[model samples]
Target chain A: MSLMDKMLALDQRIIFALMFIALAFPILSPVILPMNIQQYSRDSFEFADSIPSGSVVLIEGGLGAATYPQGGPGLEVQIVHLLSKDIKLVFFSIGTETAAWTVTAIDNALAKLPSGVAAENGVNWVHMGYVPGGESGVAAFANDIRSVKTEDHFGTPIGQIPLMSDINKASDFAALFWWGGSEGSIPFGIRQIVTPFGVPMTGMCTTNEVPNYTPYINSGQMIGIIGGVRGSAEYEYLMGMPGLALGQAMATNFGGLLWALLVVLGNVLYFVARREGGAK
Target chain B: MQIPMILTAVIGLLMIIEFFFPMPASVTSLNVTLRSFVTIISATALILGTIVLTIFHTKKVGTRGSEWYYSIVYVVAFVVTAGLGVLNVRDTTFLWIYNNMTSPIGAALYSLTAFYITSAAYRVLRARNWNAAVLLVCALVVLLMLIPIGAILFPPVVPLGEWIRSFPSGAGFRGMIIGTSLGIMGLGVRVFMGRQKEHLGIREERRDSE
Candidate 1:
């Protein structure tokens, strides 16, 4: 077979092995690639920063175990950012699994908080826990919190929590943050809270799902979006605290370069073979 | 069937009325109650699904059906997990199982997609025709645009990739959103009018025959 033919028919196992090396090498010894912050990430950061101190913001922690590493650092940083500025937070999750991971993110964030930041659980922030029933659950929780959730994620009653006293509905909060993370449920927040209650929102989703949501950002429904691990890294960078996501994002860059090279090479080989009349 | 259809209509209409109108407190209270029922019903449906799945696996195990060992695995996993969960979801062991075993497994499974996607891109992303070439180029541009090394390798890809994502891609997504919204509205009306009985689990004769 010709070189083009052989290249075009290169074993997929070889490609997989190459990809493994590309992804794993950076994780072992991370490379610091010069990166630009995406406007989406910037807008999301600015939106979070613009929320007034002491105003409560509602967050939908919709990231699960699979997505935690990608969106978790960003969520933690956002939590720290808000708590440091004295911006109280109320977190809830739609997925059963994600609710647990959300706790991990919150705990991590609280652990990393700068000295003397008020990290009170009930008084400053509260997690209403896994609200079931998808968009219906969101709408119900947005309209009347007490109806759906009687207690916080812990065993404490919602009524006993000081944060729940004045905050009853979506309209009560200053802004909404939906860390959707591949759930593709950003629309739930926008439809149930943003449009009906006029609560300005921002969100995060896996990198592949970014385009699925950019329209909402453009239309002003969502202020911005943090897309994937790179987004988490960007948020960490913008916050001037680099951590987990930055290293993962470097690995992602290496993987991307290898994938891009293979694609270009495959196409070049295809074109050459076609010109030589060696391909059908 | 008729009762469910009526309930769906009434509840849906009341929610809509509550959204767009200045409704009475009683109406608001009633809507709140109805919406809360959604959570309960959906939660119940989840339990029902689990019960059905358990039955299927149990039957498979009993009959020694195809790959029945997998059924045994499922049954064992479910029983152990559910037993611990019922005992105490907040138990240290339960949380440890989830955090250590479940969480890492979930992450590893998801990361496998990275390997699959890389191989797929190399093998399948060929410039076979005009449309294929356009898609390939667009995909490459976006891939380059997202990675940090792309800008260092070729600076112009940054702007070109940004434009493609912002304009063409954004416009296409908006169009899809609008189309889907209209389609959903159409389906909603059909469901409201009881012409769509699928949600109620009423299958058509032709569909069943096929």
Candidate 2:
């Protein structure tokens, strides 16, 4: 076999090894790569910034373990940004497996807060945990949030929570921030809250779901989107705080480059092999 | 059959009215109650699914087939996890299992996709035709634009990628959403009319020859 044939038929195990190196090297030795801030990421950051201090925002943590690597860091960074601005937040989920993730993100974000800033549950923030019934539950929650969530995630009565007293419905929220790993929660925000109540919304989605939510951004339905790993890196940059998302920036760049190179090399080798075969 | 159909129609109609119309407090209260009922039903369905899963795996373990060891593992894991969860006996043990074992295993499974995608892209993404060639170029451009190194090296590719995503990809996605929404609307209408009762597990009883 010629060089082109060998290249085309390169062992997959070799490719896997290369991919492993590409992902692991940067992760082990972190690189602070320059991230070009996309409009969507900037928009998302600005929206979070624009929220008036003391106003409440509903954060939907609609992601699970499967999408944790893609969406978790961004969620934590967004939480940090929200808490830093002193905007009270209510974290809830339509994704059933999101409660543990919400707790971890809240803990991580609170731990990283600037000096003298502290987060007190039922005062500054409240977690309503995972609400069942998917879209219908979302609709009901939007209509009368307090009614749907009579108790906080910790089983504290909503009436007892100071923050809960201020938020009666979806309209009371300054903005709706949905950190979704899958495409499940975006439409609910649009249909249930934004369209009906005219609330400003922002979506933080895994990189793959960016396109699905982009049209909504274009249509002004979503104020902005924190798209994928790159978007998360940009968000951390804008906040002047580096976290897991920013740390993974180099790995993302390296892995992406490796894949792009393989695509080019694979095509090149295919053509070369084809030409050689035709000539014979 | 008739009772269920009538009940579904009433509830569906009420929801629709509650959504579009400015109904009174009485009707709105009923709407909220109905929504809560749906949530409760969904929660119960989850429990039912877990029970079904446990039974299925238990039966597999009892059969002692070639893959029965995996079934035993599943059954053990489920029983232990469920017991720990119900008891809330050892919070640290539960969290440790979740954070260390479950989360890492789930993340590892998700990460494996990267290797598979790279391998698949190399072997499968061919430019045999003009359309395929365009797709290949578009994909490469988008990939390059998504990465930080690509943006730093060739800045123009960033806008090009955004444009591609915004127009071509966005338009395609919009079309799909429209198509899907229409189909869902049709299905909703059928369900409301009791034509799609089977979807709700209300299948017609058929007498069997056996």
Candidate 3:
């Protein structure tokens, strides 16, 4: 075979091995790379920062096990940020799996809270875990909190929860933050809560889904969006609490670099083989 | 079937009307109750699905069908996990299963996508034509723009990628969303008017009667 033909026929196992190394190397020993925060992330951070103290805000924790690593750091940081500001948070997840992971994020955040933040459960925050039906469940929860959930995640009755006493519906909250992950339920929040009650909202979605939700931001239905692990790293950076996400983002950079080079190489080989009439 | 049709229409109309019109407290309360039913029904459906899955796998294992060993794995996993979950999902054993086993398995499966995509990009991202070349360039720019090292390697890729995403990709997604919204509205109207019976699991047979 010609050199071009052999190059064009390079085995994909080699590519996979390289990619595995590319993804794993930084995770083993971390490196920091220069990353300018994207506009969408900045908008999301600013929206969270803009919330007034003591104002109640609703959060939809929609990150499942597969998505937790990407959006979890950002969720933890956002919890810390809001709790430190003394903003009351009401969290609910639409999926059973996501609800549990949300609890983990909350616990991690709670551990990192500033001294004397008054983040008492059922008072400063309440997790109405695992609201079942997707959009319909969001609509129901938005319409009447007690209609869907009578108790918090820890099995505390909602009626006895001091934070939930005055909050019966969506309008009671000042803002909405949807850490939607890969659920694609940010639109559910926009439709059921923001559109109906005129509550401003921000969202977080997986990296690829970012483009799909950007129009909502432009149309003003959503204030902003945090897109994937890079977005999470940006959130950590903005909060001045650099964590796992920043290092993970660097790993992503390494993977992307290797992937891009392979693509270019494959294309070059294809063109050369085609010119020599030795390509498929 | 007719009763379900009527109920679907009534509840769907109530929600639509409630959205557009200011309803009295009594009407709002009724609508709230109806919407909450969706959650209960969805949960019931989940349980039903689980039962159906268990039955399918049990029969496979009983009959020694293709990949019956896999069925054995599923049966064991399901029984153990579900038993623990039923006893108390918050129990430490159940939580350990979920956190260690289920969570890691899911994450590993998801990470496999990166490997496949890397190989696929190398093989399938070739530009053999004019339109393909444009797409390839755009994909390259956007990929570079998204990763942290892109700006360090090439500065202009940032703005180029932003323009591509904010305009062409954004407009494409916007168009898709609008189309999907309209399609959903059409489907809702069909369902509400009893023209769509498939959602109710009542298929309309068009075969000739012999």
Candidate 4:
């Protein structure tokens, strides 16, 4: 076979090996990536920064274990930042079994924070648990938070939770942060909670959904956004708390470069083989 | 049929009714009960999905397929992560799997898309016709706008990119949203009225006499 033909017909195993090596090498190295911090990440951090101490903030952890790598890190950083500012947080999950995952992420993030920076659980923050019905649930919460969330995830009544006592509706919270998956409770929250109540809101979404959500950001419907893990890293960096997010972004960037190299090599081999065979 | 769908229809009707008039305590209690049932059903579905995935991979490995090793890796990872998860062993093994295996694999998988995109762009941007040329130009413009080099080429392209996103692309997205909304509404009405029999896996037969 011609060189180009042989190159074009390269074994799938070789390609896979190359990819593995490329990704593995970079991941093992501690190389900082030059990432463009979109306005959304900055705006999201600024929005969190602007909130006064002890202000009420509602965080809807609208993702599950499957999407942890993307939205999970962002949620972690946001929680830490909020905790550092002494913000009273009301946590709830809107997507697939997120209550458990949200709790885990919160605990992990709090543990990673500098000694004594983490908020004391149940005192500074309370988890209201997973609310079903998507948009309908958000509408219900908007109308009357107490009516929808009768008790905390652990069966503690809302009236008893110190942070929840001040929050009766969307208007009560100083701000809202929603991390949304493709099909989650955030759309409903945007329509019902933020729009009608005029409560400032921010979102952390997967990178694929960033383009679609930018309009909401520009329209003032959403105050800011943290798009994917990169956004999470930026937020972590801005907070002066380098954690999993920074590591993940660096790994992702290295992986991207390696992937680019493989593609270039593969194409060059294919073209060279083809030229030698006089088929091009 | 599934219990969840039945509960959904019944509760949905009641919810709509509650909107029009005051619902009694019994009706409100029933609605909450139904909501809890749906949540339980969804959790069960998640478990079922995981089981199905495990079985599929296990079968592949048992059959000694070309990628049997990969299937073995998949099962091992799945079992280790899930087993630790179920046992509530969150600190050591579970967290290690999450931080090392899951995180890196997830990042690698997603980052690979960038390579595929470049290859796809190369093949798709070939000059074939006016439409193709227009498509190529627009794609390049958008691609350039996405990268930092585009801003260096022309600083105004940033705002222009923002304008294109908010105006033209946004209009297209809105059109899609409206179309999808209409389609969903139509389907929902049909299903609600019990006219969409396909969901039941039953085909209607025309009467010869008619």
- Best-performing candidate as measured by DockQ: 3
Q: Can you write out model 4's per-residue Cα lDDT over B13-94, one digit (the tens) per residue?
A: 7766765788898886666555555555555767798999999999999999787889998899798778887886445777
Mark the regions of model 3 whose C-alpha exceeds 4 Å error after superposition.
B203-210
Q: What does candidate 4's lDDT look like per residue over A225-255, in tens digits?
A: 7877778888888887777777776665444
| Fraction of native contacts, model 3 | 0.82
lDDT by residue (A183-280, candidate 2, tens digit) is 46789889999998988999888887888877788888998898877777788788887677777766777888889888888777777767867311
Which RMSD values do the candidates have, in order?
Answer: 1.7, 2.4, 2.0, 6.4
Model 3: lDDT equals 0.90
Model 2 TM-score?
0.94
TM-score against native, each model = 0.96, 0.94, 0.96, 0.69
| Model 3, span A1-280: residue lDDT tens | 7676666667878888988888889899888988898888999999999999999999999998899999999999999999999999999999999999999999999999989888899889999998999999999999888999988998889889999999999999999999999998888998899888999999899998998887887787897789999899999999999998998888887888898898899998888778978667
lDDT of 1 by residue, B138-174 (tens): 9989988888888888898889987888788999999
> Can you give the lDDT of residue A53 in candidate 2?
82
* C-alpha lDDT of residue A82 in model 2: 78
In model 1, the fraction of reference contacts reproduced equals 0.79
- How many residue pairs collide in each prediction? 0, 0, 0, 1
Each model's TM-score for chain A is 0.97, 0.92, 0.97, 0.86
By DockQ, rank the candidates, best first: 3, 1, 2, 4
Badly placed stretches (over 4 Å) of model 1 are B204-210
| Model 4 chain B lDDT-worst window of ten | B201-210
